[model samples]
Target: MYSSGPKLYHVHNCDTRQILEDYFSGNQEMVFEEDFLKFPIRNCVTTFKLGHIKGDILIDLSISSMIHHLYAACEFFKHIIVLKVNDRCILELKRWVDTRTGAFHWGHVTKLHAEIDEKSYEFQDKEGKVRSAMQHVVKCNLEKENMTEPIDLPPADCIISAWLLDVICKDKDDYIKYLRKFLKLLKPGGHLILVGSLEVTYFKIHKEKFHCFTYDEKFVREVLVGEGFKIDNCNVSRRTVESDLIDHKGVIFIAAHKE
Candidate 1:
């Protein structure tokens, strides 16, 4: 069993399966289904359908092994490149991509995606499309100048980062620094879609609590604008679900294009 103390996410042993069980698995908790799954997926569908986020290459930098966030993306972009910070997350994601035995099932969220996008008839093919578009799941080291060193990547037309900055950043400055890293990866005027938790300090997987950086919507906007991003759309939703696993006040989604 894990301890009760709040553990730093990066330094601790973060079990990908435990994360799936505690957060993404709708059977265990319904709150994340709204905040993490539905909210981001809805925003993605809307943003991608706006006819401006178009691009050939899309990069994903997300917090967990979850791919529900990419269901809407596959239809819009031809190439999807996933960059993971840890080996575990890379392996976990590849398991799903390769359809390995005992891979975590994401069918429920795919159904949710179909329902939200009103494409229920094509539900059978959604997973395949996502799998086809996602060509590479590469490991990234945020500390390096070239996150995906040794294998130089082409500038992306768009990037979708879900709940990653909030988990990896230690403070407000760290957040800005990391945002700069993402900015460097995009081509000029490339779009960025950010999905994050607002006012959340920590979350628990099982018995071990993981640190989460707390920030408000205003800070996020200010940082983005200060870094030369033009906000195209912003959506924020207050949390209505009650759960002790996480203490987030709300969730925020922003679609911005770099100037």
Candidate 2:
């Protein structure tokens, strides 16, 4: 393990490839493959099955170049707008969308999703659907009044943010603040699907530890109700895979809609 004495870098300073390979890649180098990949992808597939979650437009604010979480969503939403805080992430996502050389392979994730949904025969169509639905990969600044400024994105039918809030939020207050911003981007009665770890303090990329907000199920439920959201479904899976790369107690998936 790399020395932990150095200050941890925030998401903005992260290397796109490093983060992808270390946490989300389909290789021996990946440590959180079970927790990060299978957990969220399966959670999202089940969450999107609710009839109300689908719509004309969906905005995704997931961490890194996470295309797995959107596999189930692409079938429901006519258009998908991906917002990234950094240009590197935007480019990385585009590389996959365009099927460019050296782009990260997501076939493992696609297969997992297919097997779960009982559509194993339609493996080739999964990636294509995501590419067709995902039309925009725009830059966003959470601190700005309009996160996707100058673009004026239409209010989405649903917003799915996976593990993004945990990484970017500095504290509980920051978490609520960002929640409000996310709530504003949704249309009336639009669904918000959130997936992340419960009581996670930090996640590592190789040797570097990145800040992750620590909170429990109680806090999440209270905050969502307090922020004018009607909780629809909440599922918590105990951390079965033990690893030193991350210190998360359990994984939580919540599907709530703006009230």
Candidate 3:
């Protein structure tokens, strides 16, 4: 059997409360919040083994604060292509990926901007370039727009998303319609790995209460099968506490292959 190397991770029943309780006592890697140790899932993609280490990723879209997911993808995939639909996350991911003076994505690779829009809003620090370029992201995205298309780079081996499918199709019926647009971006036989939260992230900013929903793993499978993607694997990270550091706590992880 080929062993999962020390770099790869597989944490079953992975919960935050239990991990955090352990962390507060001493450890630093794990944390707790939604009130439990194991977290919950909406849907799950199968397990993905790094068959070939090619480092290109696409994140679909993200908010300014969700840049961490991009970093995590870089760390998890070994090689990644982070596709950002939002101006803020793209700016932050590019400005901070390297130079060793900014917020590093997941402690591994720092994504440098292959290209950035010159017309987007930009902010510099009154404190004289504080932390790093990513610190200026909030200022940059205020006027950001999706006026351009992502240039076609060399083929990528994997694609990833976090909590995106939940928003695509809430009732399962509309899921495929929303997802078909994204599937066209992937190269055939490439993989799509996703990790998403089960909680609403807007409680702190909006005047609305959020609803809890499952990602409908069955629907995810149906959509993938219909799209001609070969089944690879699927798994869920248990329900756990949400984090104020980022946003929600409950999460799910899934991996699939394109045929």
Give one digit per residue, the lDDT tens place, for model 1 in 1-259: 1256567665667886778877777686455788877888899888887788877999999887888888988888899999988889888889999999988899988899889999899899999999999979999889888999988888999999988898888789989988899878899989999999999999887766788889999999999999889999999999868888899999999999988
Alpha carbon lDDT of each predicted model: 0.87, 0.85, 0.38
List residue ranges in candidate 3 displaced over 4 A. Answer: 1-79, 98-150, 153-155, 167-174, 198-214, 242-250
Model 2 lowest lDDT segment of ten: 1-10
Ten-residue segment with the worst summed lDDT in candidate 3?
A: 108-117
In the order shown, what is each candidate's alpha-carbon RMSD?
2.3, 2.7, 14.4
- Give me the runs in candidate 2 sitting further than 4 Å from their true place: 1-12
Error of 1 at 78 (Å): 1.3
User: Could you tell me how far off, in angstroms, the CA of residue 146 lies in candidate 2 after the best superposition?
Assistant: 0.8
User: Residue 123 deviation, candidate 2, in Å?
Assistant: 0.6
Q: Write the per-residue lDDT of candidate 2 for residues 1-259, one digit (tens) a residue.
A: 1235323333336887777887788887666767788888787888777666888999999888888889999989999999998888989999999999989899888888898888999898889999999989999988888888887989999998888899888789999999888878899888888988899988876677778889999999999899888999998888877777788999888999878
Root-mean-square deviation of Cα positions for candidate 3 versus the true structure, in angstroms? 14.4
Q: What is the TM-score (0 to 1) of candidate 1?
A: 0.95
Number of colliding residue pairs in model 1: 0
